[model samples]
Target: MQLLSPTATTYSELQNAYEHFNKVLFDNALPACLITLQREKRTCGYFSAQRWANVEGQFTDEIALNPAYFAVTPIVETMQTLVHEMVHLWQHHFGKPGRGRYHNDEWANKMESIGLMPSSTGQPGGKRTGDHMGDYAVEGGRFLMACQALLTAQFKLSWYDRFPAEEHVAHGQASYASQLSDPAAAISPAQANQALANVVKPTVKAARQSEDGTSLQAPNRSNRIKYTCPSCAQQVWGKPGLRLLCGGENCDSIPFV
Candidate 1:
């Protein structure tokens, strides 16, 4: 916050956000990743695996956030995008990943475990796994708690796009509306509204992240679509509208119908 130039401040803020979430959400097990601010048309952010290497063959993954959406995107939504990509990074390292832009259930479940609900439609009942997905903070979720913790520790994102894109919908995140409906954790929508009174800066109204995720824009693709591999006859279910591949070993198969 002192004599640092604009470039330093902007990247530092994002890097700090990554570090904060890594500890609280991922237990700090994820290695450091190169963070960049590159804008992709209609894309909020993305995680590209092993995009960089040193002369010694040291490799590093890349996570790029779109600066174009910075000014217009809410702080929490920006956090969601970052974590969404981080989940991808995690899968690339540890779990079995679906090839070529396919989001597997493992990724979706991990997102849920960390407090971000994955949805192709960006809303409740949306497909949990797919290409080009949207996500929201979970109700009474660890992600929300982590956000509260990060803001409380006085983190700031100091830079943004000058010509921000037109925001289509206000992506919603939950405060404490847990799906379990435990009386101890449940809160009314009005209460959820008041939950972020001191969390988001520049002062914006907070919306409740509906149970399961947000429904602001993804196709409410059917929830019961099933696809089976033609070669191995390995049957798998997919959310309607999600493109998936047959993961059967050595089976050259087309995507799920």
Candidate 2:
């Protein structure tokens, strides 16, 4: 380590330290994204903001995502959102946008190819609430996310070819329920239900369809409750019991038990 250190006062030394510190800070703040991009075969940069004018977009040489858009959102959703933005950046480099026009069918297809896009599911924005928007607008956003996890985690799909929803949920994605679960305790019925519901009903399915073939699946008219636990406000699946359970390891509450 000392050999690379020219004098501590050297511009090279100072620059290296600064760059190293920045990398550490950024990576720690967004570790999952950093790791995913490393595995992907694309060149780009990502940064989180308080909020974004658009959910995601491509600049001259980067893709920017705002975690604030879904600040209270699950980690998988955030990842999927960022991946969606990254795909657009890729389109800027790989496809023909005809000029400054960025969002188009080409970009949309790219999302589907990798399974980053949601399957058609529930309502518009999938399941809109005060904090986070819903998943896909159709009915199979969960299935899509599952498929996406299989593609990316198992088949090693590129970031451009995957959806963040499934990736976060699969293999126990902690991003979705980190605050809601007892990491080491028995998965609560309510927590489990929420996870299942989110898995089954993805947000991307809720988007409005376009005639231009940009939308992944045709929206369905299904009106399920989206299975959320009333206690923690987590999306759940399964025939829920009377009691609510927390997903956190330190705190598992059986409200009715």
Q: Candidate 2 versus the native: TM-score?
A: 0.31
Clashes of each: 6, 40
**CA lDDT of each candidate?**
0.61, 0.31
Whole-model lDDT, model 1: 0.61
Shift of residue 33 alpha carbon in model 2, Å: 11
Task: Give per-residue CA lDDT, model 1, range 185-223, as digits (tens).
Answer: 232121123222112222221222222212234223343
Worst 10 residues of 2 by lDDT: 35-44
